[model samples]
Target: MRSRWGKARRVSTLEGPAFMNELQRAVASMGPRVLLFLTEEKTVNTVSELRASLPVSVLIRLPEHQRLMELMHKQGFQELAEAMAAPVPRTVRLQSSQDLPLVRGLNYPCVLKPSEKNYEYGARFKKAYKVGSAHEVDALYRKIEPVLADMVVQEWIEGADGDIYFCLQYIGGQGEVVSSFSGRKIRSWPPRIGGTASCTAAWEHAQELSDTTASFFRQVGFTGMGSMEYKRDARDGLFYMVEPTVGRTDFQEEVATVNGCNIPLAAYCHEMGQALPAMSPVSPQRVWRDEQADRWSREVSGEAVNAAALTGFPVVDAQWRWHDPLPWLDDISRRAADRIKSKFHK
Candidate 1:
């Protein structure tokens, strides 16, 4: 789709079957220079099928298929972290109701989340639940255990969203680091334990986190696109690995691009055997926010969100880009429709 800003954006609906069919057709007719971006887990299987059926390259940054599978499940991630000796939030995996009692001794104010975030399961409820007591945890487990086959109980990292840091990197076809960018979250929707709502591009804590991330990927022999999320424990001043997302572009990737590290384009170039241009040094601090989500978050949490805090820094809208406005428009339309339907039912 061509927007008024003169940029062509590729937009697709999340309907699996139709989406895959269209993607397969497009890949079949496209050349080697065309790169396929896999954004959601719903389409991972489709991408695998495309890999087998078409000669076109799909940008899955993992070093191997097994690594991708490992990162998809929460338990697998815990194991991976253990293997790498990387510090992570204290976590215990539960397979069945029988394993529920194991959490009795766990620290309170922990979180419960699905082991694997498949689209079908994610459509049902919140991404995670923060429980204060064992009773609350047990109750939540009983309610969700039947629907979600596997889950993890993680000790809550005591900190606000601003303590969260991300290191986004692109590993080339030859397994070389092409470029990297880092940022810190300023705020997030759903208050604590939520996806980033606003973040500022900065390299302040990038070195240590980036080194650890690169080491883990290199040890596992991973390639393509890699991003790792970490939270600095306010109590101890140490960063703990929260999760790693491989082979897909994240929502905040544009923040990296705007700050001089164009990861998506670098992945495309590496896949096509083209030499990547030298990356410019990390740009000055810039803020990126999803205004709609931020407003909603502030409303729900009653947290003060001051635009003046970002007055001196450059700001980028996460979704409503001048070049591509359709995504945000569509999101607003869908949210309005859902609200109207909910009111009618009530």
Candidate 2:
């Protein structure tokens, strides 16, 4: 980012206090009608804190504070899902050692992930862990003690990575969906435990999933850019809602634009009370991929990635763009530098 945008334009902040100070100074200098794009949880918290004190008419994705909080954490999401009667995996909150008793009743082959999206568990843990038994969960918990303390143990939805699907929607303030799109992940890093590595638009399966996601979001009065993730349980062939990406566009949000919904354009237009921007022709056959993560998934899990199978669909590389090529170059360079640094350290 520093290479792509000069230091004068992009100031990176590592700590919370420094970030808050920079954000405040930026907002103070900015003109009226601030269009804030919040992709991180800390930014959401900061924006929530500054909403009242700001001197401009800011367009925020999360219009409702309480509803936003519910979607930000694993435990809160489970509770919201239960309240909506949505098919969700049963969760046991592991906030501390005292919460261990709750995990005993859970089904084996459960998953453990941080309750909060902004959890700082360091490099010792992956985004999540799949525990084979109660004993394994207990042992893993002991090893990671205080770090995984504020986590949630959820029932594992039995299925391959291909069974994971998502529905992206930009909703209006009245809980009405302004625009929507749907897609499915074919692979994720760490095999089944990490973020989406490769995905493609699913036209045949989009309708049902989009409806389910819209219904869930509307029921909770969510009014912003968001998506709901679902996993098809191989045992019952049911699509259980895993969680939601609320108040911000998801990482794979561009997959939707590639498929022709053009969510970012639609969202911007709607926020400004303008007519929806003219959209590109729907191309539901397009595939989107993060090359780096897909490589990691393939190498780590030996997952078969047969791209020749989808000969007709064009694949959109996440990091590389034909027009804006510098970022991709920088990414590769950074990877090379890191490799050299690691070798030197060794």
The prediction achieving the highest lDDT against the true structure is: 2
Q: Compared to the true structure, candidate 1 yields what TM-score?
A: 0.88
**TM-score (C-alpha, index-matched) for candidate 2:** 0.91
Name the runs in model 1 displaced over 4 angstroms: 1-21, 56-61, 281-284, 307-312, 335-343
The alpha-carbon deviation from the true structure for residue 39 of candidate 2, after best TM-score superposition, in angstroms, is 1.2
Q: Rate residue 91 of model 2 by lDDT.
A: 90
Give per-residue CA lDDT, model 2, range 37-105, as digits (tens). Answer: 667777676666556654455667675677688788888889988998998988998867667788889
Model 1, 95-165: lDDT tens digits are 88888888888888898888877555577767888999778878888888768868899989898878889
lDDT minimum window of 10 residues, candidate 2: 2-11
Error of 1 at 19 (Å): 6.1
TM, every model: 0.88, 0.91
